[model samples]
Target: MPSEGEPHILAEIAERHARIGREQLALLRAIGRLDPEAPWVREGARDLPHLLAMRLGVSEWKARRWVAAARRLPELPGVAEALASGALSLDKVVELTRFATPRDEAGLIRWARHVSVWAIRRRGDLLERAPVREDRRAQRDRRAEWWFLQEERRFGLLAHLPAAEGAALAAAIERWAERVPAVPDEDGELPDLAARRADALVAMAQASLAAEDRADRPTVVVHTRLEPSGGPTPGAELERGPVLHPETARRLSCDARVQVVLEDGHGNALRVSPVRRFPPEWMLRQLRYRDRGCVFPGCGTTAFTVAHHLRHWSRGGPTELDNLALLCSFHHRLVHEDGWRLRRDGDVFAWLRPDGRPYRPGPPPPAPAGPPRPAPADRPRPALAAAAQARCAPGPAP
Candidate 1:
């Protein structure tokens, strides 16, 4: 019960398949045993099959096979046929035989059809110029160091410890090593030398602290971005002091999108706005208490923190108190681009890991408990001493 049109369509498809097969076989045979590097071969065979197929609007794979077959032929009849049919060019077809194997030649031709001839030639040149035995030891060393740094990054507290402290610890270990006695048994066995050295240095530092008089510490710079909400109408004038840090001023000049509250000469609030767009100062104060610090899990960064809307502001998310969370640059990126999930319930915040597991944000484990305290001295001793003193001399209350 097939329609009459179906038979005609099937016949046309069969004829096309047959024509492509014949062309492929002819093209493959014609370009046999050509030098790959020769200008004619490079130009003609580089991507002839692919280019020819594209020109004919045929499949790249089909074009490759046709070019490969034409390359193997003693005469260029197949190549000529393809050129006549506008399937290939005489310049491109000549290089097809340069491939060591028919499979490689076919693949090259197919790729050529999809890609430009210039690209194929460039790739060939690059491949020819690539180093075979270059020294990679330095690269390997760098990779190892990179991996070590990545591991170190996971321990945030340790990562942030001053480099000077690390150097001092190393020096202490070296000094301790000089004082320790060497033993034949120690040759193959590792000792608890590092821990012993650390304990000795810690005790020495603590003793020094007890003897030295403490002095007033230097004031720390407060670098924070503020976002105020509510109160006065937008566009109120606020006085800001001169920029103390040139780098901070420069950064603000380039990308001053942080929200801040402006204060007048008398310390009265003026307005709130993104460092660029001025809003009322009272509004900025409203957001300060809600976002105490960066809301990102394990991030203590206060500077460069932004008030991010959990739901986008453009999508009808409110610019009010409840919808905003303070996030540093790194955490903001994680929430926006990286696949970290965040949820807030009442006052508590939860972070979900990449594997859909909840992250436990808690303090680090406490050090192991010390030995039990000694028993208290008996009260009878003090009482006996008091009695002796009373017997020696009766005294009135002072």
Candidate 2:
């Protein structure tokens, strides 16, 4: 079926790909020759992987693989020769380097040429020898981190787990993903499997949070300015996280259990108020009974909803039923962080944008409303109460 020139074109493509592999081998040799300590130190990187990631604009994961392979190449001359001569692809070489020693590199090189990159990688994984020391190292290396890209206003997560635990977690996510319904785009095409997995992760988190007793839920504390300064307020800072935009702080405060810490301009604490950060269980039940779900014009999510204070508690607002509403996380952010506002006229609420235009004309008919089904009877609370008391017990003076 091939045209006369098709075979020639395909051969040329294969040759070019082989040339890329040779170039990669040269790069690895160059990396191996660099004084590993001096460059990373001068570049302010913790290790070769960090430096490579920053300089090459590669992912930390990829940088790590490259660094490991480069370190092994000098000892495995056969692998280096195969890659440099374009007999072995870079991907196959990288996987081989993971388990290859001087004695085994030649055999792996020959076997790798006949197999796919994934097969070689799987072989390397199975070849790994797990001794006690390696097990200890695995435990030591287990870590998870959250990194923020300030320019993109996004966060990235990286996690390294021991093989067994990682496999279990992956299985859980895959199973959850299977249960997640596919969401169609504007063109009616469903999201990809990866996106569905992300949705599954979020759903898992929601379920976990919902299972916790109200009194045992985690609290996030955001330190922010209530007093107006001469200039525009920059943003609110989290006690344990990065600085948050002002609007973000507002959105978080909507439903979060928060403590009010009053401080003077000089950063000296004036007082720490003991006001309840969130409504008591009884009050929350009343709120659910009243608002039913998110009060936003069209959003009616009932699960994982939070109580929003129409008049923020920090601004001398009372915590009475008249001042509270139920909102899901998304619409809550829309109001606090995204420049949307709500106006209450009797029992109805109106949505307004940052530019003061209405989201919909007048009061849209009330969102479909109903209280959540009654929960089971409460469990004994002594252990939880004790834990709370100990947690609130002031830490020893710094």
Candidate 3:
């Protein structure tokens, strides 16, 4: 019933698909063999997953799966063989590695070939270990701590919860996060789910404070020198918190209820001024209308954004519409606290990174070609015996 060349064409297609599988296996093995201290660190990648994401043009989630599969391939010869032979796919192998032991990999390969990738993943989920029975030790281990990093001017929360309570808390945060409007990330993509959860937690805290009826909400008192005889007063100090960078102080002062206090070198207040908002209201409304959302490329968040002064008002910068730019909280922090710099050139704004390079999204250009590399083998073997020998190598008897 088939045409004469149809079978040949189909056979060639099959051959190439199998060849691709073998190539993927070889790539995974090489990734596995990479030294922990690879050159990716120097390029600003935090770890292997980040490096893979940047260099290979893949998502961090996908890179993590590749790294995980590569690490286990050295122990699963049968699984590697099936992948190389195209009996199983890269997705199937990645899922299998989640729970497949070397001894059981042969059986899994047989089962995987007859089923869909989803089926294999479902089976992997089922095979993963479940929570242990809660006991006194588990209850005693539960803890939550709030810590601050002075140098980074960052705060962190760490918690260890019992499985039941942790699940409940996670579900609550997830539900609340759904109510929080989604925002675009640095790359202009929808924000990471983890970030939404963090925002949800902050929203919960804000809601708790809003319930209390008072003459005025609690205020954060920042001690700053109005007169900068030097280049700039080093920074402002929070009443009970760590010292804030000058840029951070300027950002807070932009739309805040600011009460300026002229203090002497002896720490006595010389004059106290009435509290007032910077830029007033009409100018802020016009600035918001002109910029709508964050002016940072790709970030279009309209909520929780502030008007940033192109030049600090403290240094004789004008409080005019031309001197303002709308920025989201994250990007504002980047411009102020982080070493990123932003300036307007005519109607266009230029963003510069810590190293003074133009800030641009997307991965860097690929490195130049080097010497031709060796091709991968069709059938690779695990060095089980060699590993065992090295672990039990003979030494002087103790």
Q: State the weakest 10-residue window (summed lDDT) of model 2.
A: 389-398
lDDT per residue for candidate 3 within 110-201, as digits (tens), equals 89999987898788768776555534545754655454578999877766677678899999899999999998878889978989999999
On TM-score, the candidate that comes out on top is: 3
Instruction: Give a tens-digit lDDT track for model 2, residues 173-239.
Output: 9999999889899999998988898889889989998998546555667665545563434776777
- TM-score of every model? 0.25, 0.47, 0.51
Q: Number of clashes in model 1?
A: 39
Candidate 2 lDDT (Cα, 0 to 1):
0.68
Per-residue alpha-carbon lDDT of candidate 1 for residues 1-398, written as tens digits (9 for 90 to 100): 99989999998765543343333333344334433335321111224543343233343344544444454544444334443343543234433333324335545655555665455445654564334332242232121011123655631111122335546766865776655554334476645665455455556667679999776332222132223443322232213544334223322322223444555445454655433421123544565456655665444345556666655443466555566666665566555544566677788677776567776644333332542223343322222222222222112101
Clashing pairs in 2: 258-277
On TM-score, the stronger of 1 and 3 is: 3
